[model samples]
Target: MDFKGLWTTIKKNAIHLFKKARKAIKRYIRKLVKHTKAGDYSVLIYTIFALVALILIIVMFANIFSLGGKKKSTLDITTTEVATPADVTEDPQIAAQMALKQQAMDIYSRNKDFIFLVDENHPLAEGYSFEHHTLNCGLDIDKRIYNDFSEMLNACNMAGYEYNIINAYIDKATQTELYNSAVAHYVDQGLLEEEAQAQVGKSVDKPGCSEHETGLAIDLTDVEVLGEEDYKSTRGTDQWLMNNCHKYGFINRYPANKVSVTGVSDEQWQFRYVGREAAEFMAANNLSLEEFMELVQ
Candidate 1:
């Protein structure tokens, strides 16, 4: 009977409820603002990111400068390599006489055929004559072969080993005479004169190159003082020469196994001075001068 009035009352109540709901939402919004103002986590997150980026930048800059410093150091060290023999020979700074004199003497002596003058006038004629004057039986190498072969001789006297210089420098004339004589001997033994001469190194420098002409090469003889039984076979002062000679720039040039490479026999008595570093390098590697030259190339 009063349904319309009841509907109007319900509508009024619903409007009041909507107002209350809106006020309640506004209060919660205010509360959220207050909590955010107290402390915002967003600032902390941004600070952390910034700090990480700063650290990365510093690390990168440090790496770049470190690499640059190393590059500069490496460049400085790459500048110096030792000069080779050919380089020294060709350099205008080095005097030609220094290079040519040794070669000239070597060539002249070879052409004259290794006739070493034992007389006073010869360059190598006079020096100290030791009490012991021979080594390795008939091997007549010079006194200069050892580092201080003379000093070694003195030591030998102290050690009771008889050291000697059976032969020293053979001049060009002497070499030629020796060659001719060897040739004659070969002919008498039934070989042709030219063939016999060819067997021995010629003073002309056409066939056999004389290592002796270098003045660095030498042969030894009569090493034993009292005609000792093991003179040739036993280890004598020459063993000291073989083991320590490289320190003084000499090598057992014609080593036993290297005969085929050197075109000469295993000359236990022969030694050649190529200088310490070169000799050590050669002997250590078992290389001949020709082989070493190739390696240098």
Candidate 2:
């Protein structure tokens, strides 16, 4: 109902009634003045009493109408249509996005325990197996995380942040080769074998101890800045990935500030998929995988 209009009409009628009553009271007072002049003071007294009663009645009616109108206004305000989840779900695009988010959350919940941290101390288990899916770029990753990884790269591309996957899914033999090569590089610098191995261990993971062995880590870099000495310091694809990868279930596995906790030097290009829930929590709380695992465990 149009309560405002009804209230306006009531107000107008009250004003009109007040105006009419005022004119009648004026006429009665004038008549009482003439009666008093003719010595009929009793008539004047009664007229004065009637005028007071009439004013009281008008004031009582005005108060009742005003209170009723105010209550109706309050009711209208309280019952105003506010958007609820159901209302928001009415939009098809929003509903679809919400469904996708829920689906991702469900997947994360189911695989919450799959966030295995592979580092020097926590090496990949013997005969560790995972289904692999090869991307068009000829890099293989864990099949379970392919969708999230692809979506993340796709989002990066959409945002015009181009990147190249430098490495992913290195088998134990490949990890061994890389580790030996790093050690050799140090040895060629005139260091003893033992000293070279120790130095290499500081930078490179030894075989099964590498996160790449899990098929859940990827190294990303911008083609434009690939060989730059301080590529990580530049604002490029890697930086963008580091800032936003968590939204797609990835985290900067070796953040520069957390080197002490991770026992690895900062590698801004490296990201590890730990599922959305864990990834987001780690990102938000600025936690390394080691710290996050400790908290959850």
Candidate 3:
């Protein structure tokens, strides 16, 4: 190994690197001095302009924030001032339902006491009346109710159970007369005028309040067995009616156990025509007409 030659080569390389490093450091110092020279006002002016630009950018951002805050405040003010009285009333959905109920009430009032006895020879029914007896009394049921009641009657006839319609719509005069008769009976039982009227359903309903007066109710009697009062007893054919009336869009209006709710006696014979869906829902839910009215209206 030529140790002396190797040492000489290393020494020469170290000197060369030292020169190169010194030159690079001098060049960097010169550049830094050139930028830092103080006689040039342009650099000072540029620095001042840059500082001003920064301040302007900050001011612009602040203005944007202030504008956004004002916009938000204006929106809140408008909302607070523009809300209307109608907007604060009861729900529109509820109002619409109440309007429908009012319409139904008007319709019922206009048709009060108009009897629609069952036409045994209706063209639509092919000469078969739903009623079993010759009296053939019934209300002019709503179209939907008529369809379901007709279907139910057809089914009952097919099953050999006899259904009869004893009465239907009664005008205001008839309702008043019936109510008066009841009041008289109660008065005979020793109740005072007001007390008797209240006890017998004569006071709460004037002629118009009775569903019967609306031409949307009917009184039915089952005649499967002889000497059996169908309306008074809930057995046999009467029981069938009680169980199945809801399916046919009819409900025992003054049903047993609902005297307090109805302000009337239980009339197993009396039925009111509601739509099938409504009848079934009311019966199943144990809802009285007033309760149903609350839900729907």
Candidate 4:
């Protein structure tokens, strides 16, 4: 029965029991008075005991009904089901997307320490150092990622793409010099030192802020396109590298479209190692390092 109907029934039964109890008490009182008047003290004692037992029975029934009602109410509340967004059957496309994201997260969790951010806004900590392996081309990269980098270069060679490593793993002093030189070039054009620095900042990251300081960034160029005025052009080897770098745990650190977000102009040759899974995730989503960091967080 519904809670309200059951409660009504219990109330009616309780009222009937109370009425009967009251009638019995009244009868006992009358008997007690009669027995006292007749000088029968034993009958008076028996009537008093009977009245006490009847009251105890009434109290026990009241407690049982009260407890029953409470338990019913509690059961109704506890067993009630509430629908939510998560309960719906997931779409196949969405499920596949979620699986990919979970896979990326698993990869990220295993390599989060190595997949760090270093940009104009996020500088490397002072005294930062890493075990590094120098490539046969004389460029050094973080030792932990050497195998992946080597594999990538081997793949590029096998694909018949001719390229040269222009820069990698710059020390703070060298980065400072590069920064100063860029600023000097702008200053020679009659811009004030501060203005020149501001202009240069868009292209050259200031000293400690450079990703090369972490030994995980590399700059490359097609052998034919190395001396071009527009180094940002993705011709020949640059095109191949940009298209396939993610497969080997590298990302084009600065894409032309993400200039505003990265706070640096695009260098099509610039690539950074962020591990295979992260690179693939970023590539798939068209995310820069800054954007990827925000997304995972």
Which prediction has the highest lDDT against the true structure?
4
Which runs of model 1 end up more than 4 angstroms from their true locations? 1-53, 58-160, 199-208, 225-233
Error of 2 at 199 (Å): 1.1
Model 3, residue 230: C-alpha shift (Å) = 7.1
Lowest lDDT 10-residue stretch of candidate 2: 100-109
After aligning candidate 2 to the native by TM-score, how far in Å is the CA of 243 from where it should be? 1.5
Would you list the C-alpha lDDT of every candidate in the order shown?
0.55, 0.82, 0.62, 0.84
Look at candidate 3 and give me any clashing residue pairs.
113-170, 113-171
Task: Encode model 2's per-residue lDDT on 81-182: one tens digit a residue.
Answer: 777676678899998756655644564467665687787778888999989999888989999999999899999898888788888999999889989999
Write candidate 4's Cα lDDT for 128-230 as tens digits: 9999899888888899998988888888889888888988999999999999999999999999999999888657889999889999999887877645376
Q: Kindly list the per-residue Cα lDDT of model 1 for residues 1-297, writing each as its tens digit.
A: 799999999999999999999999788667656656888656556656988999999999988988878454655456425566755766665655454434434433442322222211223322323222234444334444444555545654565555555444444556556656777787888888778767654222321234553355665434653332334624666666666656655666656677666554545566665655566665666776545543433
Instruction: Please provide, for model 3 over 124-200, each residue's C-alpha lDDT reduced to its tens digit, 9 standing for 90 to 100.
Output: 22222232221234344444356666777777677667877766656667767887888889899999999887786
RMSD over all Cα atoms, model 4? 14.8
* Model 4 alpha-carbon miss at residue 221, Å: 1.8
C-alpha TM-scores of all predictions: 0.49, 0.61, 0.47, 0.64
CA lDDT, candidate 3, residue 50 = 82
Indicate the worst ten consecutive residues by lDDT in candidate 4: 80-89
Residue 243 alpha-carbon offset, candidate 1, angstroms: 2.0
Best by TM-score: 4
